[model samples]
Target: MPDTQLRPLRAFAESLRLDQVNLTERWMRAVFHDTELSDADRLTYEQLSDHIPAILEEICGALEEQDLDQVEPAIERNARKHGKLRWRQGYRIDELVRELDLFRQMLAGQIVQFSESRPFFTRRHEERARHFIDEAVSFVTLTSIREVLTERDRKIDEYTGRLERANHELTLKQRLVGDLYESRMQITRSVVHDLRNFLNVFSMALQLMSRAPAKVEAALALANRQAADMKALVDELVEYSVVLGDNHQAAVECFDLRGLFDELVASCSPAVEAKGLRLTAAFDDTLSTIVSNRLKLKQVALNLLTNAAKYTKVGQVELAMTAAGEDQWRLRVSDTGVGIGASDRERVFKEFERATGDDIPGAGLGLAIVRELTRVLGGQIRFDSNEGEGTSFEITFPVRLEAREGGEGGPA
Candidate 1:
């Protein structure tokens, strides 16, 4: 193909933002075939640069021998190249016919203006050109409308996907809020129930003091003890609330678990003696040290010991320690008291949940606080009990000296 002939097509393809390499190849092929195209036809095909190659091939093949075998192939090729090839949608075929008709009319007009010597021939060509132009224009318009609709549908799908994700997030947030509300309500009920029990005990002590002037000393002592218990309950409620409400860091320390137990036993000796309960401590001297929050651990140990002493009427309340594994030790506090029922075992660990019995006194926050404090110290607490027999509470803590140090430095 001559460089001059290819130049116009190349310039037109560039104007349409079509690839230069692809347009150059198509233009060269057309010019090399020695196709009969007038100056006006060539210029119009260049202006409609994107459709030039397919339009030319279709028109030329239609004018050839009437076998019509090449027609389907040519239509399929153009359709596939434009990504519009679909048997169910005949849009591409229609577009090809329309463009060919436009090309023929432009050719006819060029012949009429330049061929005055052959007026009859120019008029005949113009009539043929008009017929093809009408057919081609109708098809092109249909295909273009379909393309626009496809784009609109794609955009709608994208928008619908975004809406679905937003709705899913809203549903998740709603569920989380509901869970938070329920937990808050549970905590509130527990605090109120514990406070009511403390008030009842205070009232009983005051009445006892009023009825017997000779027993005033004993009544005042009992009242003071009840007041102290109430104060401890209030403090626990506040601490638990603080733990749940804020992300406060706990102070860590290394101490002897046996020593802590000894201190708690000494502090509660008066209560044990008053209740006429025997308190015994059997420590595994080899398994002593544990790194944890010293104050919290002390509270847990004292609470469990006092609880055992409070409920037991006769026999012994034993605090025993044993090695659980290579790096863990178990501390079991067993009491020969009115044991917990099977159904109440699990519930007792929850705040304000007490076994159904008339003799048991004070609020039911001791075991609950023990459970919470044990968890905070990175340990586990479990119990074994048979109603009318006895109850045993076992707590496990890591014992390895290195592990104890590591726990001291770890997050609470």
Candidate 2:
């Protein structure tokens, strides 16, 4: 590299510096077409010139020094800045490449003008000048492309993170909806089971009153009690929809336990007799009328009697009321029925479960309801059974005495 070989290239680089902004403006006008970009999207002359002057100065220094080490860092910085700006401004990759091409052409055009006008300019100077511009273009374009790709990868990761969060929220909502549906179904089944029992008892009382004209007074009294029980059941159904609360009522009313048992025996006698099972009731003379929800007690008694008669095909079923202690009493239903096995005793208390052997006509809800009723009354229920022999269920609870309510007698 002789001084003669580099002098023309150095002069061309100097001319580019003198006219850098004018060269960028000319390049912008040639490439920034109205069809490709609007005034709002087009970069200004200062932005277009970016590091061109500094780079031209470095190229001039490289002409004398023999290497581009002084310009490489500036070239990299300009490329990265151009990449980021174009990416944020929504410029296409082709548009960025075209802009670089126009800048090179503008510089080359200046080189051509210098060679044509100045007598000392030659072909070698033109070739070296083009090579310098080409090298700088390659470095800037590669760095710009790398910056653009980095930005794209960052956007993809952000989008993936957002999608995962949205999926998590959707899954949570689905689970909550499923749990709510299950809870509603359980409540519906419970209400329907309770209402069916009250309605059945009401229907039975109506039938008994219609047939027993000789005992019309007693039948009417039983019908009245059954109607009241039906009303309470309806009220509970409405309340259950609003809130799941305690099932027992605290309203105290006087009613004869013996009469309640007598009514139950009467209503269930037809069903028992149809099965050819003898049904016997023995009430203690000292067992006074109780002050409690008579309808609830009647419900439990009816459930027990019905279950006893249902399974018993031979022998008999007995309903007994016995004094248990100073403040408690026991109501027992013993039957010569198909008894439950040890494996089945606890299972029988669960909803929709029945003893294994018998295809007895039931929905397996009678004993479940009875057990719930026992709990509602602050009592406990237990049964002793010898498989294939018999079962005796005893429900023992504190007797709420009529005297506590300042009432003297049973149902008139």
**Best prediction by TM-score:** 1
Clashing pairs in 1: 97-136, 98-136
Superposed model 2: Cα runs more than 4 Å off: 1-8, 34-66, 119-121, 174-187, 201-412
lDDT of 1 by residue, 1-412 (tens): 4564333323322332333345334454443343333322333333435544564445334323222344645644453443242222333334434444444444344334434543333444444433443343333434444544565467579998999998999999899798678767866776676667777877887888889888788878887877777777677677556544434455567887777777777887777878777888787767767766778767777777877877788887887878897777887888998899988876887655678563455546677667766766667777899998889998886553233432232221
| Per-residue lDDT of candidate 2, residues 3-94 (tens digit) | 87777767776777777667656766776663554432456666655655555565556544545677778778878887777777676677
Positional deviation of 296 in candidate 1, in angstroms? 2.1
Off by over 4 Å in 1: 1-236, 242-246, 400-412
Q: Which candidate is the best by lDDT?
A: 2
Per-candidate TM-scores read 0.51, 0.47
